[model samples]
Target: MEDQFFELMCEKSSSESANTSGRTEEFLDSSANTVDISENEEERDKMTNFLQVIESYTDQEFRRNFRLNSSTARMLIDRYNTSSFYTNKEHGGLPKVGASKEIYILLSYMANTNTFREIANLFNMSKSSAWRILRRVVEWLLSIGHEYIQWPSASKVQDNMRKFKAMKNIPNFVGCIDCSHINIKAPVSNKHAYFKRKQFYSPQLQVVVDADKMFIDVFAGEPGSLHDSRILRRSSIYEKATDDVESKFPFNSFLLGDTAYGNSQGLISAFRENGFLTPA
Candidate 1:
């Protein structure tokens, strides 16, 4: 996924260089005037159809399709609006699509698991347009979203003790560790590495979530065929756990995990008993 985003960014940079005149503020303003009134109405109706579909969804339906509740989705859009490239009026290039709506389009691509063509049809945009919107929004999210996430500090670990104990009688536990596969298009080269035993091609996404189910850390880009333990060992978070964090808060503070992650010094795994696993 990261590589794909970089490739898209490179493509965008090249395209921008070739179309300097088309992107000028005067050209953008006059381009709208060049279209006939009927064409303008048609474009408006297309956007309206897109909005109508979004509005018709109930709360659960909306969350199912977009993978975020309405409020969170709106909040993300508000954050995106802070970016100079995403704001509508001040930008010159193309007539801007809705900041909120374009975000919804990208989320639908990610959450609803649709192809670019399907999303384009749903949003009343061209296939290339949908792809461009997704690439841009993803770039922005990757840049800004990580600022809000931090690993549990020593005090934070201490504070969550009671809540962790109440949930499962576990003491001093800070977070859960797990890995899942994110499906992706087959790469042009080295296609064999991503194929898993389960007969799927994907990239492994390792995540650590605190008791509240918020992601504290994430590591991606490993091939799906790799073992969980190997991915964890290769991740920077694993290095932090062993080299830095373990000595400072050694007692009762550990990460909970499954058998796939193996027994490690700073991590705990469930015990295997008669094919069932007991909690660490």
Candidate 2:
């Protein structure tokens, strides 16, 4: 499981180039001169349908949260051009799912502990399809979103003082990495060999994220049985550092990890030995 998780992490691209124009302020003002009203309305309805599929969130609830209405939804959907619903076919990319995106629908329902069967019933998809879509969306977010996260520069560090909670002389920390687990169904009878104890428990990454909930360095992807330290040892980020001749924070830079990570010159753990606490 540790090896597989590491493999997935390695699948993460190192590319940083992302089209910011499609997502930010420029989107806000794209509505005014955008002539075609029907096209815009179709896009809006897709988003609204998308929103409706996310269980437990009603139209009233969405309006309350976003401070917008049915009318505003049109502008928003137009601005949020990621959906293919209203795109002119001559433009590019695959077509929209016609109904709300199955991916969106699955994620919306995933916020809680809805069974695969229940989710499938609600979305009119097979349980396997629902699960597959959930995994793909997660991969997309981890791939694109993780790369686009720029570290807070020294110039912005002062402005971000609020994200920090000073400890000793150290300021806001990026993270104190940890791992957690979720319940999962056991494998089928003949596939028992493929199931590990951790396979019955899905891992969740926990990082003491900064203001943006972005990881400074410490991150999680270990199996339930693997120590956080061992996870770090096998991580591609660590591999890149240890193997790179020009890496900035070589093995000399300090990091904080779980008690399982222990203490090293370059890695700090809040350790307590024989009832005596060790100072950082």
Q: After superposition, how far is residue 91 of candidate 2 from its true place, in Å?
A: 20
lDDT of 2 by residue, 120-142 (tens): 55655445555645544443444
Best by lDDT: 1
- Model 1 worst lDDT window (10 residues): 2-11
Give lDDT for model 2: 0.40
Residue pairs whose backbone atoms clash in candidate 1: none
- Candidate 1 local lDDT, 1-280, one digit each (tens): 1112111111122222223222222222332244222222222223438677787888788877766677677677788888865856534465668888788887776676676556666787666577657756765665553444456667777766567888989787788889988665554446688889988776677777777776666666677899999989987677878788765345558888997777776688876676565554
Q: Model 1's lDDT to the true fold?
A: 0.64
What's the alpha carbon RMSD for model 1? 10.2
- Pairs that collide in candidate 2 are none
**How many residue pairs clash (N, CA or C atoms closer than 3 angstroms) in each of the candidate models, in the order given?**
0, 0
What TM-score should be assigned to candidate 2? 0.53
lDDT, candidate 1, at 199? 87
